[model samples]
Target: MESRPKVTPLTRPSARRSHVPPLGVHPTPDGGIDVAVAASHADGVELCLVDVVEPHRDAHDPARYAERRFPLDGPVYGVWHGHVPHVRPGQRYGFRVHGAWDPEAGQRHNPAKLLVDPYARGLVGDLTYGPETLGAVSAPRRPDEPDSPDGRWWVAERYGAPDDRDSLAHVPHSVVVASHPGPPPLSRPRVPWADTVVYEAHVKGLTATHPDVPPELRGTYAGVAHPAMIEHLTSLGVTTLELLPIHAFADEPRLVAHGLTNYWGYQTLGFFAPHAAYATRSARGAGPAAVLDEVRGMVHLLHEAGIEVLLDVVYNHTCEGGDDALHVSWRGLDNAGYYLHDGASPAALADVTGTGNSLDFRRPRVVQLALDSLRYWAEVVGVDGFRFDLAVTLGRTQHGFSPDHPFLVALQTDPVLNNLKLVAEPWDVGPGGWQTGNFPPPTAEWNDRFRDAVRGFWLDAPREGSHGRPMHGLRELTTRLAGSADLFGHSDPPLVRGPVASVNYVTAHDGFTLADLVAYDHKHNEANGEDNRDGSDHNLSWNHGVEGHAPRGAEGGDTATEPWSAVVPLRRRSQRNLLAMLLLSAGTPMLTAGDELGRSQGGNNNAYAQDNEISWIDWDLEDAARDLLDTTRFLLALRREHPALRADSFFLGTPRPGEDEPDLLWFDADGAPMDREAWDMAGRRVVQMLRPGPDDGDAHVLLALNGGLDDVGITLPPAAGGGSWERVWSSSWDRPEAPDDEADDVTLESLSVEVFLNR
Candidate 1:
């Protein structure tokens, strides 16, 4: 491992003592802008003030712009500081880092390249990707291709190239945004982990095609906080809106080439800036400062309605792909210092994130950059929390992943970040990357095991497709439904992360939606441009007798083009089963954007590249979709009304100290407690979970699930809640309407789940 200095907070030098107190474009007392950038090993760095020739540009064309450069004062504590008196808000600016062009020594600096300030709060214009934009220095390329240098192509053995080609014309300019207007309002409805119901939605998709959101404001940040959107969130009992990445990001060059964009916004550029594309056209015209104001305005509105906003942040890698040839942004500034490199050779990247390059958290400078960006968003943007995408990369050390890594410790102890809802997508592609249950206490991690287990039980039990094998045994399901104590319940150091540590969900943005899980057995990812080989094939899904949507007629027939009306019951019931398990289970539940309404991506499991109708939510729901929405509302309501469903602590399964009945009672098909053999056996698909409310409370919840293909009668044990059973909900019911009374013994329909409440 390359040796580097560690920066403990106590030992770190103060920025104010050296002169510039803050990085990025901060307003001065005298109306100038103080711009600071961190380039640790750069020989020289210049702040460039650019003038725009036009607000728009053509594709594969040089941006109409020019630049005047000013040398930064010093490399003080790795930060280059300067004050530009002429530059103000909306003023286009960027940095030109100068140093060695050697790649083996971990330096790819070319003054011809325009680098983005890592702390840019507002990025103006989008990066136009071409040879000039990607790199000014010629990189070794294909033997057959011509080289484009100085805006002209040369094909003389493809060897002629311009060394002095300035890439400023195609590079994005970082805008000097003035400080935010006053302070963001301090009122936040910080939802507790137990009661928090996270609705994971992309900011644009949530409102883009909504009927109620105004036409002009349909896909903007303002639309997300609009009254129409807020009303839906409130009505659905959503406590937190976990938005997909809204940071300034660039679509992958491949996706752009295919005329598709990164809809999920996973690839990040400026971590501090809100994506300008998602802002209103007026906001973009008003300039970069208004873009941030609109984001804060969204937060303020959601906070007022007692809802929290959690951002899905990507800190693991930059949009600068792994190619050492690209001299833009981070790669241009300090390639060696910013990103992790293979120890054997610095030219090759050690990318654990599978995103081309992994940011080196081992370096304190990069750590400071992330910490600063987070503080900016939480304190300045006024957002509630952050869900770190591929968070395992952040906590990975030189040896492997560590729970007590410097960055993890800093987050747990840092005052600003400690109060926020820190979530981790805890796994990467590197060695020992599966750290799902390994994150420290007081934070949650997305539980893929929970996802797989649930999907296997409901969808994979009956079929042995090329997709995968049969269902996982009852033991796995029981463990996941009860908060996966075997995983997250760490007794070491006496820190037992409770049920809330698991962020339980069966579907997310990267995979098939809940609707697709019921409607398709195979992925239809032809729209993603990679043919059908792009998305995951191991989708534990069962198409209800037909692929895609089949009309609601021909109930008694079985043919190739059969309407498959009989298939509808099992599909609907299965959908209900997934949602009920997600909401009622002992963990923090995350519902995807359109999953509540049975939204289908036409079986495209991975829709990361699809930005059009296939990805944008269709809010105008049909009859069946509307029914799923109502079911979602009711499920959320049940979870809210009963504290037992959202348990703060994990159930021990054994009887409590003075009570004969355990908090949770698990049983098999015959209403008998599950024994060792039953827990390990397959084909025994019937299970009942009985949960008692708070101590001495009269209400309780009983959930019965039968995965069999035939209706089975099961006897209900004596009521633990001390009242007759009211059939609160059933997956098989056509309407799923008002609750009906049921006898002690009830017949569960094939492929169904039933809920009963003792009141």
Candidate 2:
């Protein structure tokens, strides 16, 4: 008979417990690990030590692995704690809390559902979406039961009973990770807000189809850190690289049923754990520890290239979803405490986000969870900052969205978080959720108003003629083009929230690409399995008479047809106009990943589910794409070199003591100063904006924009301080090559933009 290895017994590390144990499992100085979890309503919490199963045996089968459960000591301020000797790093574990199954009171405790640690630093395995992971038995609504407002009556059925199926197999195992020594501390590239140019991209989509990236490293953390990828970012002159959600996430069952995955990764499973799928295959083969190191490597490489990494985090919701969804973590541990529920119906979830459930930021523990996760990513993971998704939900309290909400206040007060970049999406689907420009100081917001105004002035207004009405005036466009003082400025204190607070962008990941905004008026999201009914219909776009792709050669084809040959050039010019407005504006600008290269999703505004080529950026450079990239580079260089465009404070309009003209002056096509009526005139589509240099010694900048159907003559105003004007960039050019110096009179093309500098 084969001799079996001797089994060792776990020893007790200590009996004394502190006032409050730190949450999550931490390796002790002794050989053991100390585990603590917050489960307020649980009667007893058991720590389950799991043994790795054999490769040949079904690794996903819970019954295949041996698990030993130990009761922990706690309920001291709602925290459960314990210390087990012999548990080392890389050990897989989970929690099972025993409590009353009273759904009406929001105390959902099912010991059979193994729960993931909310503070787990690393996780292994993928969450299998099935009956095993669902904490409650999902039943069909009875004929006698009344329907809910959401129209899904079966969602209420989750409160009926506890599911007894063991969830150890289907759920991801939380692994104990010890702090490993890494390369010397990264020197962060803390680019100031004024000089910050955010380039929002996806870890996978950005490099998946990159031609130069090694095939094995493509679409992985290592891929982003690859030299080829870093070169692109550096060459583009973007100061910050904002990546989409990298938190460990799971695909919703509905998406999985339709043979699709959550490509956007908004559904977060483990905040602390790096999304394992994003790691290179080599790192993944080495386990969770290696996966985390890959993420750090990416950040380190980016920082080395003088680029900051900002994660688009989803703290408002979890992958567990709503009442009828799976319950792998928070819900199973303490449902009443972790999630927000309706005041009248305690069992029903309060979903401010379009997602099924929203985390209750009102609760202290929930707030603690989010803060802890953020600290881990910032300090341990080495990311420079975060862009919080659905940030308005985080600021929502019992009363409503408050600037002083506990979570928001805590972030401002926290020593680690306050110094880091904090960006808020600034809206949710909840009541009174539009809280733009209401966030605290030092926090920048995604400026949707700037996006709308720029799109309307360039793409919409000309397509839909403005018939001499005050409604289509330059007031709205100018407000956004300037610092948007009407929205971000405080008259009481003057420039309290400066132009830095507005993150201007014409296109984001959620909307149409820069090319699509000019090529398709309607969204073509037929592949999302929603029958093209999903995605926003309020896209303020103009197709320039073409519905889909322009005739051959317009978008890199062999030859071009009649109107399309003309329309395509106009579309490309419109794109340039939009890009120029965003970069030249006196606010921090954000550029979408493939917008510079003119990448399009074939009119699919929302490609959150199409994980294939539809979302991945194609690296094949066409003539138009190459020109757009060069134009982007030129604009970025202009913004970087000129302090006028990157204003630290709002323009005072009045000239400084040493200046010859007002700090900013607006002129009409006739070269005369614009009056009140001219500012509101609808048919008046041409405007010349002049901004003085930082000092009398520097060159003053001039921007002349013509947003009409017919070309107009613009008599350039005399330089702000009186030097000759030289035309630098123009949308009329096929390439970004500097245009010849022009005199007083220049013909501005229809729907085109021009930039000039006075030296």
The list of candidate 1 runs beyond 4 A from truth reads 1-20, 53-64, 136-163, 181-183, 465-472, 491-495, 551-563, 657-660
Question: Could you tell me how far off, in angstroms, the CA of residue 136 lies in candidate 1 after the best superposition?
Answer: 5.4
Give every collision pair in model 2.
none
C-alpha RMSD values across all candidates: 6.1, 4.4
lDDT of 1 by residue, 274-367 (tens): 9999999999889888888999899998999999999999999988876533456998788889999887553678989887889999999889
Candidate of highest lDDT? 2
RMSD of 1: 6.1
Candidate whose TM-score is highest: 2
Candidate 2 residue lDDT tens string, 633-674: 999999888877888888888866776567788999988999
The 10-residue segment of model 1 with minimum total lDDT is: 151-160
Return the lDDT, model 1, position 725: 76
The parts of candidate 2 lying over 4 Å away from their true place are: 1-17, 139-156, 180-183, 466-473, 551-558, 657-660
